[model samples]
Target chain A: MKSIRGLLFTALLTGLIAAVALTGMSVYLRVLHELDVVFDYQLKEVAYAATMAHPDQLLLPLPSDSASYEREARLAVQIWKGDQLVYASNPKRPIPKQRQGLTTLYLDDRQPVMGWRVYTLYSKDKMIQVSQPLEARREVGIGMAWRSVRPLIVAAGFLVVLVLVSVSYGLRGLKRVASDISSRSATSLDPIEEAGLPREVVPLVHRINDLLNHLGHAFDAQHRFIADAAHELRTPLAVIQLQAQFLERNTDEKERAEAHRQLKGGVRRASHMVGQLLALARLEPEMGGSADEHLSLDDEAGEVVFDLKPLAEANGVNLALDTDTAWMIGDPEALRALIYNLVDNAIRYTPAGGTVAVTVRPSGVNALLQVTDTGPGIPPAERERVFERFYRLPGTSAGGSGLGLAIVKSALDKLNGTIALSAGEHGNGLKVTVSLPRAGEEPTEAPESG
Target chain B: MRLLLVEDDRMFGEALQQNLRLDGFTVDWVQTAEDAEVALSTAEYAVMLLDLGLPAKSGFDLLSEIRAQNNPQPIIVITARDARRDRIRGLDYGADDYQVKPFDSDELAARIRAVARRSVGRFSSLLAHGPVTMRHDTHEVTCHGKPVTLTAKEFAILAALMEKPGAILSQASLEDRLYGWGDEVASNAVEVHIHNLRKKLGKEFIRTVRGIGYKIGDNL
Candidate 1:
């Protein structure tokens, strides 16, 4: 969109350039016109004076004597009364033709006698013709015209520069809008600010902001649906869990044992699904339920340890961690989920004797958490898709809700961070790295935690 | 020993109550946070098996209320919400332990007993299997009442093994419980502990299944 300053600048420049061209042409024509009258009158006067002097030659050039030059200045012309052309004391170049009124003719091979006005005076014996070149006349006219055109040119240049400066300032609003939008995660659909827009541009900004608001609302509704569904589903699952515990209380030996197993399986499945559902719901940015999650990954990592290594060992996989002190801004629960999911995924997919290693380091302005697993590596085509919701790679026996990586992606995105999946060390398995910015940076890195 | 089972689901609650009674826990069962509140208000329970998802109020809320009232009941929060937050939240709200759902009935009973014993200030109870016996409180071993001497590490290893006779315990778990989290576990730490244990207690007393974890002698 062209700004108002740009439009006005273009209009002014075009008008000024055209005005200059027109004024120059008109003044040049006017100069020729005025020169025609003045030179013709002088020619006639000079011819009459020379004729009155009764020159013997019919076509004589102006005399070069000092007295004649003085008389020529008084007459305001050059007198050509001799038959052969002669040099003039005035040293002004002569015209070639004896034509009446304004006429252009070649005086020399290179120069043309333009706008030369002519007249003739005839006596009984001799005819005299007087003429002057038009070059001198037009120079004065052009000089006068330039004085009028200079201000327009200066004004036009200034207008253009002012427009450029103002236009660039106006364009910064759009750039700010772009930065604001891009800084948000995939699920963040907040409206761009409409304040500080140009009067004319405000409508467009309003429309865009309105569209963002609608999108945000839609995302909110979707997330609310999931959250409500998960909440409602918990009651029945809890009922069944309690009922299972109740059944084990009443049944006899063999029946009681079988019931206990069935009950346990049901409760475990329900609990697993509930955990997955919560993680998935939290992944959506519009819900914004995780906004209050302000815990340092560095401090949390140092203090919190759940003894789940037994699960890995029981599954015939080796679990190890490379610890480092690196602080980051994130939800502590989300960080735990990220680590747990990676480690759990590794243990699930890895064959017996395989090793999984987790490393934490401080990335530039953020903390870097990496999990490397010696399992069947994810195919290149499926690597990016793995972070998507409910996207499970084909041909794996691992039973999971497929929300693990999705949650990690969402959490990292919220922290204004990034995650990358790559080939593990030595090209043997999968390595996933997540980087989250530190807290208390610019603009309060975390969402408002209330 | 008496066990108090607090659950909201009618069927599961009744079944668990019956099973605990049969397993010799003079069991008292209640449904809903209110009923559990009333039961705790009236009667003394040895150990409270609390389910987190209750009808009137949540198990976490009840646990907090119990703590707020200064009622020092040893609570084991059993719930279907196995998320890390739920476990941590329950612990923060004054639960002694957090167990995820679909747990083995026998394991639950064992945990209940262990927690009950811990509440009364006993570290471990004497475990007996046929003719073999290990005393955790006294740190001694006996075969048919004849005392057997074992090294410190060997005794520690035997105590862990005898504590859970049938269940297989992984090397990492054993190491974590024996030594703290920051302790460096040697490559042959478990092997050394097991070898020393076998020298004093008969080698057949502890069984090592190939490619899996270890279990105490089942046929002792």
Candidate 2:
């Protein structure tokens, strides 16, 4: 929930304040130094002026009127020749000096403690000294420092205001984009308008638009599939309804029986189509499955063959299976369905007396599965179309849902398998070959065989 | 009356053909648009019941091709394409009517009869010429206000002739209307059906021109 404008405003304002503070501090320090320079110069001027007159005139009362005022502002002038004090501006606080240059006196020869900026000079056997109290320079420096730092403080305040206003102004485009996205409906996958957007944010918006385009395409494809599935279901349902109506209205017993038979067949076809459609819907999304179960391809294929043996026998078709140790990790249901559909389609399409053979072989890297049937094979031109959902070969009499191969394809995709179709046995039947990547870690020996 | 059904799905076409037959219309079925074109060129179907999703040369192509040749047979498109735009395109391609799939068989039969009737400048399913009155929907006929039983072929023949009274249909055209392909047409099947129709509707109801055809006359 952190706002970019707020953060920028805070950082910039803090930086400006720090810079203004440093500038103000340096300005105040420089003013104090300059004030000390002026005070030191004045002290020397007074000491030299006393020497300008003759040594005898140094005893006359120098114009150090600062002593007439408060004690804090007083400038005391001292003249002495070899310890015989000649003159003193303030007799109560007489300045003492040992050096001929400037110095401060905390305790003069007999006076109490008081600090001073002292200037002492010896001219013609007479020492001239000028001392100013430290308090005087401090008051002047304070007055000058205020004048120097006030504008900087005002500018810092103005800079803070400027940063806040500009930060908010610069972020208005982002705010507008957020509101635009929030106000849209879930189904509105239209691309966001990039006009007038800031440069740094353009890449992010472009990526979002790309994602939206993909989502829109996915939604469209899903919708089209559903519509096609529903449409395909309608014809079967219509047949069932019409047959039921005919069965009800029929008066002749023979016709009634025929209608009843058709009704049953229609219901069976409709139910079979529904089951296949459900299998496809369930398998399409979780491709390869989120949770894969380690299972043997041979075992699943054997299970499928075992289940379909009765159907094969009834149709007078011989069904057989041979397998080797082939292991894979995938959704067991998808695998089972895949094997079941391929075999079931072969059995249904093959005429009576035809045979279907399923073989599984593991070649270390890929698990190979082959299903060959003595059925009327697909023409080379139509081999690719058999995998499309609801596409049926012309004049195909088998009562298939038309989704069997489509389901098989989806299941194969889940297992990361490839399927190839070609003529089987003297070019008279269909052979579907599937190869799935084998799983790792082989057991010491093959456990079961059937 | 006879119809040509252009549907690819065998079971659907078979069931629909049977349903239409029970409704007293002879229906000839073809699985592809090419076959439909062959059938259309050879026979004179009263109306065309077309399915759009054929194996090749879709019904839309057949429809436009036939209409482009100025063939005026009424066509009713029965299809799974229920979109509004599809319907508009179908009608724009010169189809007389459009019927969506999974439709009631009875409604489809009625629509077929209605379209066929409109094509012949008739507005009702019942045809009245002289003493015979035939109801297309009920497959019932009455002569001089008395109910008379007629076979499906008999009803089809009388309806065909009664479409435009006094309009002569040649013997070959009469046979075409009376039977679909694969129907065992007796050597004199149309003659037999016409004789039966005449017996049921009175002797003078249908007239035979010497070298031409048969027609129902307004002057009974």
Candidate 3:
């Protein structure tokens, strides 16, 4: 992992090093230039002194500071009279004679350096040259530059240390956040603490808290759903218990057989309740499984009818389905579940010899599927409430789970469909009309929960 | 005892009715608060089993209405709503007891007996008269320290008379203890049950006034 603190500290230290190196090089160059002026003056002064002593020729004395210059570099002097070498001091390597001005010379071929800076003076047919090595000046320049830049390097080092400390302090918020999150249990979806957070990190925390809010809502809904399912199953369970007791109480063969049948029915009801609950739960969180499938609603409806034909027959309800090319885009399994619940509710509510007809056709560029039952229709005041989970109509004696309409609504919402409930054609039963935009036409907007 | 069971779920109501009937309770099961109101106005009951989640009208409102009218029949709320607030609300609205659903039938029967006993100012489950003692919980009847064999209907008739020793019990009221709303009752059914009770517990065990109802044979 790339740490913010490490990255910042390294960057600051590199900048300090580069700056310090540039300062040192410029100081070295400036010192070398200044030394050239001072050394050239000394060379001129020495040349004049040599010229002043030139009348003595071969017995001329050196300059008063010549001893010190010799210790540092080999200081040499020469005099030329009428272009002939007249006087020489330490003459093994002579200073090259030049036109009367200062010049650098390579006195020997054995050395790699520019050997000397020589000053030449011409007076009254005699030339005097005073010279020194360039090596000594370079060493002094380096010492002066080092002395000047040492404190700057120390200050830069201190700055780098200070930067590292502040960088780590600035990053403390992120560390606190990581530790805070890691210490919490997975079930706690509370918002991250934002107190004392850096400004740069506040937005990120806000977005995370928003996500946590959504997760909390989803979990609450799941919990409520589970509780409601358990609560609803109890009614069927209570009936099963009673039927079992009734089975134990009856002595006659026929009565026992009847009780046994009722007991089986109760078990079947509870099992159906469980199946519907699983379907509802799966569909509750973000469009259960695959939500996009190109299929015909009429075809799915036919499959649902085929599946529920046995249940309808058992209830003595005459089931009918009229199909057409009412195509739509939806999850095939969800559509099947939606159709099954509607048909099952109709069959359960309709009395014996009653008819439940499902018709599919296109209505106004939209596919419309209708389930009409010859049973008691919902009162207009209670029509809106029938879609609530676990809401049953008053005085209706069917052993329905009260989740049928709710499941249909859930699936319809996912498919971007609309449902309308009204009285059937004869005005004595319920007609549930569901309309969805066909697959080929202009698409609908994204689904929103009802 | 006669009980009025108000529940919206049909199968649950039927199953509970069957079981309570086997427990020697004449159960009048209704699926709506409106039907319950009608049943309450027409006949009195020993106890009422109410469910809170009724369609069109909730049982909570029905309970408040029942209490407002000062109907003093013992009410036991049997519902799937197990939340504490709901339980408190049901009891506060004058229910004799609150029972969560999927409960044991035997426990429900025992509660019914206890509430009925409490309502009638009787602390004990046994109804005693002269030489006979009847245990409603166990359905046991004894006379002179010896157990007596009696059918459920015979036991019910004897219990009704012994419940209030000197009080007269109308034939119709006694029939309510033996039959539910749909049970077919012969015209001479009460007479036949009384004759058989007399034969088993001695001919003078039950006494009848010529123009009124019957009472127990002897005073306490």
Candidate 4:
């Protein structure tokens, strides 16, 4: 994997190297130009020195050929008195008289070479000239430029090492966090420790820790739900097993007939529990957030009441619906589950000849649904606890999986709605009120609806 | 045997009561702990089947109450709570046995019989006196090595008498053992059953104590 430390180190190193190279070249050219100017000045000084000398002294040639070979090859001084050569540093070759000023000229026609930087000045009847080979000046200029750039090359090497070390040090915390995460077990959702972290990485660590906290809660809830579901399923299965055993042992036709009936009843209860469990699982928050369409709360309530009317009649509970056109945005199946559970719970808890009434209508910009039943209402303390999964009111003889209100609560959560349970009229019954946001309404009404 | 069943689920409780009745047990089923407590105080049960979850009062509270009152009725806990802690708590609270729900009916019946046997200080399902032998599980009785069929009521009465051989049992006590709370019995039902049992088993198998009740003679 490409590491952040490596990327930073490489980028800094490349930038430094480019900067060093650019500065090195510019410094070399500047040093070379300065060196040329200094050399020309020295040449002019040499001509002036010669011009200051006596005329007899200017006419003298070199003392010996061997001693003058190296010096004469690089520097040639010559003097002329009215077109006559009076002094020459190399007597074997005649010096050319050039204009009286600094100038450049090639020395040999057969072997071409950049010849000289010559300085000539006139003194009375004499011309004093000083010249140096262009090659020699170029060599000196390059040597001074190298001296200036050598230190920069050494500093560039040092900078590369420094960048690598500091980048690694700055990124150690990130590596530690990565390893800590990789070493954890799959079931571990503990928050990552954030101590001693760099400020650059603090926000990332905080986000990860938050995610872990949420995951831990989700996992815990899932485990509890599975355990409760299994526990609930065991009772009816035991009943079925006991009934099966009764059928196996009983020989009397009358006794066998009763056992058969009970066995069927056990199966039915188990099947119903299974169905409710599936509905609850499907309504979980994680499974929600799919596309929702505009649905009429009144129409949904009417359908639920129509379907449960036969059940209400069988139990001798009066069921009624009072509703108007109330539209909402929600999943149809989830809304059905919500309505079904509310009405079912009411009918089951209400006594024979009791009343269960449902109402749905638009109040302001919110769709309000109310279910009032002349049944024993939940106590103030138990109203909140009833939404817990598989939690049944103690001493209640109702035959349910205890998932009805829990399912209702989950559905309401999916619909972005709120539910409140309070005492009904005269404090003799339970009243459940649910409010959902109206579709195609201004968001200004949402806060009030909630 | 007469058993008390305390459970909150109406359908499961009714089915279990019916199944227990078919297994030759007269079961009185109550949907709440309050009713169970009332039944326990008012009547005698051979065993009590308790469920942990109830409408108002938990079965655990009822079990504790029964124990605190020094009631010696054997109780078998039948519940949906199968956790180890719940099992330990139920047994530690003085239940004779513990069974998780979805349990085999045969296993539960056998456990009930075992607990009842321990309570009565008897270890066998067979109750034998003279030439008659009855197997509780099969509800089969044989006289002089020949199988004989008896009505459920007659069988119940004979089993009650044979439970304590040579001990006089009043008609009321025998009727309690032969029927549940809602069953209606004729005034001479026990007498008619004893008469039929005597005719079928043999004339001298059971003896009637004048104005008291009936018994099986030990010397027969």
Candidate 5:
């Protein structure tokens, strides 16, 4: 992984160096061109100066002294009369004259001098020319250009350092967020602190905090659920233990038989509790995902009633279903569990010769499912509390883990439905009414299939 | 021993009652704290097995009531609430011993006997008089270093007499200890058991009181 500082520094430095180099090149070429123009003007002036001098003086051969040698190395002066060379600044090199204003000619006759820029002026019976080596002109132009561009190279280096430091400073908040998350305990779901966060990273922090909030709630719910399950399992286990003790110590055959029967009953109750707990866990709202299958609530309820008929018969309770074809979009398994819990609860609570009736029918744009039982109903004040997990009403004789209504409520919530418990027919028992939107209606929320 | 059991869970309470009966205890089981309070006020119990989650009033409230009334019936709390704080609270509320649910019924019986013995200013389950030693756990009696096998009724009668040495116990009280509700007893059942016990052990073991019932001689 590339460090943000390194990446930013590299990119900015590359751009700065490219810009400096291009600007330097353009400045050097422009200065060189200007120097050429000035040199040509100076050449014309020197040729004019030579023309103004006496023709005899221009023709005199200059001696090769140190000062004169330096002057001749840079500048070459020549006089031509009638296309014949009368005089030259370097006697070993004869100048070749160009047509007029500015020309370049290689003075290679000396085998060492490379090139020259020459200018000529014409007067009556006198033609004077002045030239300078091209190497000398370039040396002056580039020397001055270097003086102008040296600061830009230095500034580019400084800019790279500044960008690196600033980029690292800007990215410190991201590193802090990473370390904060990494150092946290696995069980800790607390939100990350957002104070003093960079503007670019605040949205990320907010999203992470939101996820932590949800996770914390989910963990808390799981913990509470496990605690409640353990507490609910204790009583039945205690009953089984005591029954086994009774069976072990009793010598009377009748008492032993009774103990054996109670032991079996205790095992059955414990098994039922475990099954209900698993059903409740499976019907959790978060477990549902994209339930798009269309199922009939009437058919689902009929199946649940058929399955629970034996239980109702064993308890001597009359179980009946009066339902029509009512279609709704939901998970078949969850819907079945919902109906089973309600009917099973009703049958378990109702006395012998009592009745438990289930009905499902379409009402307008909604499907209504109801279970009415002739059992001792929950009081109006305690009806809502009964839906809480593992909460059994005091003094009730029905053997239950108290997760039946809770499971029903959770399933209904997942299906985007509503439930209400009120007095049964004739106002003597419990009637649970559930309403769900019919298929093809605008759903409150799409149900997720398990 | 007579014990009062206060528990709301019907199956658990009934099963625990049956086990305690088999352990040679006359258990009066009540389903609510209110009924427990009433029973405690009316009867004498050797110890009480109290469950915390009750219908009307909780066992905690009943424990406070019992302690406030100076009732020292050696209450042993048997509850499903096994949190450390709950156990501390139960003990603080004057419970003599605490047992959590799903506990071994034999262990509970042993603890009951231990607490019952402590209430009577004894520290051991073994009742020794002269050469006779009765082990409560195994219900085995030894006389002169020889094991003596006794019927359950005979053991119950001997245990009742050994509970308070030299204290006169009425025939009705002995009958109460020997039988629970619905157990058919002949009118001379205590006499028949006493006769058999005398024949098996020795005539000098149990002494008959003239107007009272019977007593074990303190003299070895």
Candidate 6:
């Protein structure tokens, strides 16, 4: 490609140079033609004076005066009248047969010869013929042509340099884009928001941004699925551990009973985790084609489970729900997972006798689902990482596999919901607020919901 | 109380049955959802301890079928999965309560009795803890059978404390009970409720476990 561009540029430059040279040369040739006529006329004048000076001097080429005159004038003078042999300088020179007004003639050596311009002077009973060789005038005309073309040659050279410099500079944007895209890490799908220098590059930038958005979402889903799976596997192991412990120290029925109880709790934990994991995996957006995969997550808000207030009360945490019955379009199971996670996380972290209030409200077009807890609030810097899979708060002794918020975030993404973490009422605890699309939208109706 | 236990693990199920019998409850053990269904069809159980991971039919499916037949019997789901979603799911599908695996047998028994008693609509009497007794129906309190004068807020505080014998009740929880949703609660509302409850019920009834929450115990 580079060679092709270079060749094209060279061809254009050569053509332009040739055009200017040809134009200047033609004009110089025309001026030389006019000058040749004037030179021939002077020779005729000389011839006329000689013929008048002596009537019997017809065939008079051996004269030293005429020869010296011709040499001094830089013209080979010849005189021929009425088709007779003419007086010519250095008699070896041939004269034209068709004697008339000035015209070009060719010599035996192929040099151009100028035809004589005659003054017949019939009243004086004599004729005058004058001629000059065209070599000297031809040399001067060729010199003028070269002189006219020198500037054009230089200008064409400068133009080629300018074209090279500007074209390479203009192409730098493409090179920058290539480097930016190639150097990116496999998982970094963040879009490039900076505008390119040229308008022509905008389309490419937009396309890359779109691809990055899709890739980021895909990675998020994958991460959530893995975390959910790990959480699901933990419960059964906990159950096995409890049962083993019970068997190891079975001195009394009370101890065995306690082990059995612990085993049951572990099994429940494992099963619940597995169920949530499966749902999360299934709900993850498929690779590519995400734009059309509109998930109806808003309608699921009405599918409330057993009221959580009793559980909160039993745990000595306050549960206050402020929203009316609202619908969200998303997987009902996933929504339940998100809500349970938020509530569970609140209950676990809140000091006993501390309040955990859950409120669902209408925020603009979307539903605002918030869970506020009177626990120690997450720091601003760490708030973003709390959504990552298996990320638990730093100092809480709460017993959890750490998939709660991860599942919530995964589900929220499917619903195109937004979540924000901020300080709670007293600015002493964490408040997680989420916004989900309103129910009954066409995107929320999943084909498999039935 | 007679309890029916549906579990797939034979050893664990048998052990649980034996232990529950010793804990003053007549226990019936089954290994599959099908057997549990048949037994439940004919027997009367005060509470059903259902394991969700049963063979042949999942415990959830059995519970759904049972609920479809208009059975409102208290069912507590027992599973090894500790995910909050699963517990809510089980409850959403009509299970009464959920308990994770590796739990204490005493705690399980306590939950069952509490659920079973509530299911049987036995909320007319007072719940007595040490010298403090709070009548559920009338929302009245008595100490050593002596009439105890308490405000509505103080009564709620003491009721929350008495409900969970050894468990801690966070100050936030007490305040939530006192105020409804959207009702602005002062920051020190729970402290005030605790102070009022102490003045009426004696200071030792509610123990302040600093940095955690408040707890009530029989020793207090």
Please give the DockQ score of every candidate, comma-separated.
Answer: 0.06, 0.45, 0.66, 0.52, 0.61, 0.06
Candidate 4 local lDDT, B84-185, one digit each (tens) = 999999999999999888776667889988898889888899989899999887889999999999987888888888888879999999988888888998
Give per-residue lDDT, candidate 6, residue B124: 40
Clashes of 2: 0
TM-score, one value per model: 0.47, 0.88, 0.83, 0.79, 0.82, 0.40
Which candidate do you rate higher for lDDT, 5 or 6?
5
lDDT of 1 by residue, A1-450 (tens): 866666877786787788778877786777658755665566566667775653344235445324742243332233443455432323454544353443444456555544444454444544455554455556555765777677867877887788778778877887787788789888876677878866766788788888888988887778765654554355446546545655646556777676767576556655765787787566667667565455666555433224558777888888877777676655566677666676677777878899887777876677877778899989888888888665566544243555667777766666677788888989889888877775542245577779
Report the CA-based lDDT of candidate 2 relative to the real structure. Answer: 0.83
How does chain B score by TM in each prediction? Answer: 0.57, 0.93, 0.97, 0.96, 0.92, 0.57
Which of 1 and 5 is the better model by DockQ? 5
DockQ of 6: 0.06
For candidate 4, the lDDT comes to: 0.85
Please report the candidate that would top DockQ against the real structure: 3
Q: Which DockQ-derived CAPRI band holds candidate 1? A: incorrect
Model 5: per-residue Cα lDDT over A277-366, one tens digit each: 988888876665646578889888998999999999999999999998888997777787788889999998899999999999899989
Tell me which of candidates 3 and 4 scores higher on DockQ. Answer: 3
How much is the TM-score of the A chain of model 2?
A: 0.83
All candidates: CA RMSD in angstroms? 24.2, 4.5, 6.2, 6.3, 5.9, 22.3
What's model 4's interface RMSD, roughly to a tenth of an angstrom? 2.2
DockQ of 3: 0.66
Q: How would the candidate models be sorted by DockQ, starting from the highest? A: 3, 5, 4, 2, 1, 6
Instruction: Choose 3 or 6, whichever is better by lDDT.
Output: 3
- Model 6: lDDT of residue A357: 75
After superposition, the stretches of candidate 4 with alpha carbons farther than 4 Å from their true spots are: A29-41, A44-96, A101-116, A121-126, A133-142, A243-265, A440-450, B33-46, B55-73, B83-96, B118-136, B139-220
Candidates ranked by lDDT: 3, 5, 4, 2, 6, 1
**Model 6 alpha-carbon drift over 4 Å, by segment:** A2-12, A15-23, A26-123, A131-298, A304-340, A343-363, A370-398, A406-433, A437-450, B1-220
Pairs with backbone N, CA or C atoms under 3 Å apart (clashes), candidate 3: none
